[model samples]
Each structure stands twice: as C-alpha cells, then as structure tokens.
Target: MNPGLHPSKVTAQFEPLIAAFPDWHWEIRNLTIEGDYLALHLRVTGTHRGTFQGVEPTGCRVTTSQFTLYHLVDGKFADVWDLVDTNSVIEQIEQGKAVL
Candidate 1:
C-alpha cells in the first residue's frame, strides 16, 4: 500500500497482512544480509484489529519477532518468505499467554 514495494509484489505481500490483521504495523529490530537476500529481523506489535485468516480479533496486544527473507532478482524481488511465530502470537492474543 505504498511506493517502496515493487508493484508486482505489493499485492501478494500486502494481502496476507491485511487479511491477518487489518491494522498491522511493523518495526525493524535488526537485519542481516546474505548474498542476494536481506533477512529482516523484525519486531512486530499491534492489536488484533480485524479478522485474519478466519481468526477473529481478540482486542489484545501481541508482539513477535520474525525473520523475513527477500531475495532480489534483476532489481526486483524474486521471492519473499519468512519464519514467524504466528502460533505464539495467536496464543498470546487469544489465550492470554505472554508473548514478546
């Protein structure tokens, strides 16, 4: 939903976030670079503001860390993947477990 992301990749990347949590916001806690990929060691904290992937918001605060790997090809991202603890976040938000 911004100018920084590649036009082609934007929709794919944004959809998951929008669907999972409509008001999701992110912060970069750390980063690492390897060859053609940049690994974003991120810290994300926000409210479960909307429905995401069939999960309804619990109106709770949750924080989690994730490493997102983006591989660039020909000046555009060829692939985007991440290792995130979504279950932990869900546990914290819905089950009252502490996360972050």
Candidate 2:
C-alpha cells in the first residue's frame, strides 16, 4: 500500500488526492461495506488542470467510472484494488464522444 494514500486511513485519501488533483475528485455512487471488505462504485471526474499521464493540462472535464475493493486487516486497511472503465474514458478522450 502506498503510505501517501490516506492519512491514517481515516478516509484520508481525499487529502493526497486533492493535492494531486487540485481540480476534481472521485464522485461516489454506490458503496458497500461488510466485515473487512469494502466495495465502492464511483466516478472520477475532473479537469486536466494539472499534470496527469505525462500529459499537459487540457482544462477539459473528464468523468469515468471506477470500481474499487479494499481488504481490511487488524481493523486497519490491509489491501486494496480497483478497476476503472479505461477504454470508455480513452474513447471519450480520443473520439471526442463526451468532449471531455
């Protein structure tokens, strides 16, 4: 796990992500938490106001879905994984399907 992610794991990912984003955030839609497993379905929306993927700023609005899962251990988070609709986002960017 990246220590930089989340401050003490107390929903603290927002801090680092905000620092990196400085533009937008992950808009959550559906979240499920049971036992040591955490599941989340959300959308990552933002403008390329900052450097991302070695690409310069485009100032375009981007929105993409993300599915994430986290594993908890000893009460604190232990492991996590996530999947995003990369092709959809890429097509949107390349084909101007969403213009963002």
Candidate 3:
C-alpha cells in the first residue's frame, strides 16, 4: 500500500481511470474470507478511450490483474491494501493491439 494514500481517497484516485476506461469491467477471479480479513484476486478488462497517466488514448483493449486485501473491524472495513499489474497494462497499450 502507498504510504501517502488513504482509503478514503481511493474513489477520487480512480475517477480518472473510470473516465479513461468508461467500459472497464471487473471480474472476481478468487475470493477468500478468514476471520477479520478478506482477500480478492481480480481480472480487469477495458479499452483505452481517454487520456490516462499522461498517455494519450490508444484505443487498445487491455487486460490486467489486481490483488486486494481488506481488514475488517467491527463489521466495517478498517484498512485496505491493493496491487495492480500496471506494467502489463502499459505494455499492452504500447503494443497498440487492435480493439476486438
């Protein structure tokens, strides 16, 4: 998890991504719950339709993986950590694969 990031700011951080990939979809590949912790493995798919991270739209369909964990406290999320395969997404965009 990024030290400078707080969970409350997550939505703001993702707003640009949502705009860039308006049709982005998330699929849960795996999920686990144990005690006060929950974990997820996810597959994300989308087409680059708008500017993102200073990269111009390439119209490339991209697939990436994400892993996330959350700590629950008294039935509410108290902390969250996540990792995304951003390098893969960038490589796919740079490859300029035609959208299917």
Whole-model Cα lDDT of every candidate shown, in order: 0.73, 0.66, 0.83
Predicted candidate 3 versus true structure: per-residue lDDT over 24-97, tens digit per residue: 89999999999989999999999999987778899999999999998887677777899988888778777877
Clash number for every model? 0, 0, 0
Off by over 4 Å in 3: 1-8, 98-100
Top TM-score model: 3
Task: Write the residue-wise lDDT of candidate 1 on 1-96 in tens digits.
Answer: 222456657778678666666666789988888787888888877777676556687777778888898887766677778887888887886775
lDDT of 2 by residue, 1-100 (tens): 5433354665575554344347767888999999979899998876545545444555556688899998887676667887877666555444434543
User: Considering TM-score, which of the candidate structures 1 and 3 is the better prediction for this target?
Assistant: 3
TM-score of each: 0.73, 0.66, 0.85
TM-score of candidate 1 versus the correct structure, residues matched by position: 0.73
RMSD over all Cα atoms, model 1? 4.6
RMSD, model 2, all Cα superposed?
4.6
Error of 1 at 21 (Å): 2.9
